[model samples]
Target chain A: MKSLQELEEIRNKTRESVYLRKDRAGIRVVVGMATCGIAAGARPVLLAFLEEIKKRNIKNVTVTQTGCIGVCRLEPMVEVYLPNQEKVTYVNMTPDKVSKIVSDHIVNGQPVMKYTIGVDGR
Target chain B: MEDLSLHILDIVQNSISAMAETIRIAVMEDDTNDRLTVLVEDNGRGMTEETVKKALDPFYTTRTSRRVGLGLSLLGAAAEFCGGSLIINSQPGKGTSIEVWFPMSNIDRPPLGNMTDTIITLIVCNPDIDFIYEHSTPGGKFVFDTRLVRREVQDIPLGEPDILEWIRSYLSEGLNEIRGGA
Candidate 1:
């Protein structure tokens, strides 16, 4: 079983970096987590984002969840909001697509145009 | 949803939307009694009697964005299908408590899949809220309360990647041990 001591060690190591990044206007990644979203496997997609972000050590991105985006057909939807850019909504998200989104859009600042709802026509 | 944990994830989202400050999730399994129970209690804005009735109806919902509120209804169905029951108790300004029980041996009862993901997802996404998760099996019991972690971490957010990773491992290991090890 894991202990509180390990958690304390993690806190000690990461506190300074977290404090430093607190003041910046970071990017936000929001996953739709409503009934439709969960039924369509949004949990895995959300987990994928968190894993990818953590594995890549991306500090300035905050991954969160939202309620329905009103597109039930496109259930597992994701919306990315950069610091000063328009929000990009991605439809039909899957765990398989997380890495590219993280690498191209989050890291390289280049949105994958083909995956956006705009290109997918809703 | 595919499993009970997904149902839990869905129900907790409703609590989050209701602005719950604290959410308690408990899973109890008794092999001798052949019973499994899942309880979720939240300090959120409680629903009225009329609203509670409507909440059980699949087509009724409070949100304009969608006409269907299937979270509770689906869970109720899942419980009923497994020779179980789902009970909801609430008051206007107090809170809401949802309890679900299932026959442990029922073949139709979905597996309690990936609670670690459900918990970690909730914790990291809603960093400000406190979550208490308790799981008990024939072997042992394990409890995780974010309040204690919050006190220990002080200024560090629960959503910090390192903290989240630590939480994931803790839950995975703790849950496995309660189930009599991997």
Candidate 2:
């Protein structure tokens, strides 16, 4: 039975041992998770980002969620922000698309234009 | 909502938008009573009596950008279809509590979906808010609180990849053990 206390202990110990680098000035991946997004199946999309990050052992990238972006019709949206760069908003995101975003955008510094709002004509 | 967890995510958004500082979500499955109950309580800006009355109405909404707020209404319809009821208790300054109960074996009752993602996503999205989630079955119980993690890792973000992954596995493992893999 891993209690909350035990989990905290694990976090504390790992925090010291891992020694995370200070250069997280990396990309930020934000998923829309408002009522509209949730209704459109954003949970799996968010989980997919986390899963891909762990699977690839990627570092410096953070996955987060936000409320409605005011475009409910183009929901399940994701926005990636790199330091000192314009935000690339991806609409109608899915679990499979998350991997490509991670590898092509986060790792290679190129956004997948097809899934983005700029090309979607929304 | 397709599942109880999705409904929970939707309901919690209301609380978050209300600027809730502490939110508690409880899920209880009682075999003896043949009921599955979900309670989401939050110390947020509670709605007025009139607003609460209209919350279950599909046409009513607070947002100006949208014409409808269907989250609560959908959950209410789902509960009613499963021979269950949904209740809301609130005060303007106090807090809000929503209790939903459904028949455990009802054909219309939706299965509880991926709760692990629900919790992790909530925490990751709203890093400042504190969440307490409890799941209780006839066999055992599991409790997760953000205060504990925050205390230990004071500076680190909960959205950190390693920490979020740990939290996810911990929730799934705890639920699996308590439910004895169903």
Lowest-sum lDDT 10-residue window in model 2 chain B:
B153-162
Model 2 lDDT per residue over A29-99, tens place: 88888778998989999888888987887777777878789898898999899888899999988888988
Worst 10 residues of 2 chain A by lDDT: A15-24
- Candidate 2, residues B101-176: lDDT per residue as tens digits? 9999999899999888799989888888999999999889989888888887677777767677668777898899
For each prediction, how big is the interface RMSD?
1.0, 2.7
In order, candidate lDDTs are 0.90, 0.86
With a 3 Å backbone cut-off (N, CA, C), the pairs that clash in candidate 2 are none
Question: What lDDT score goes with residue A22 in model 2?
Answer: 64
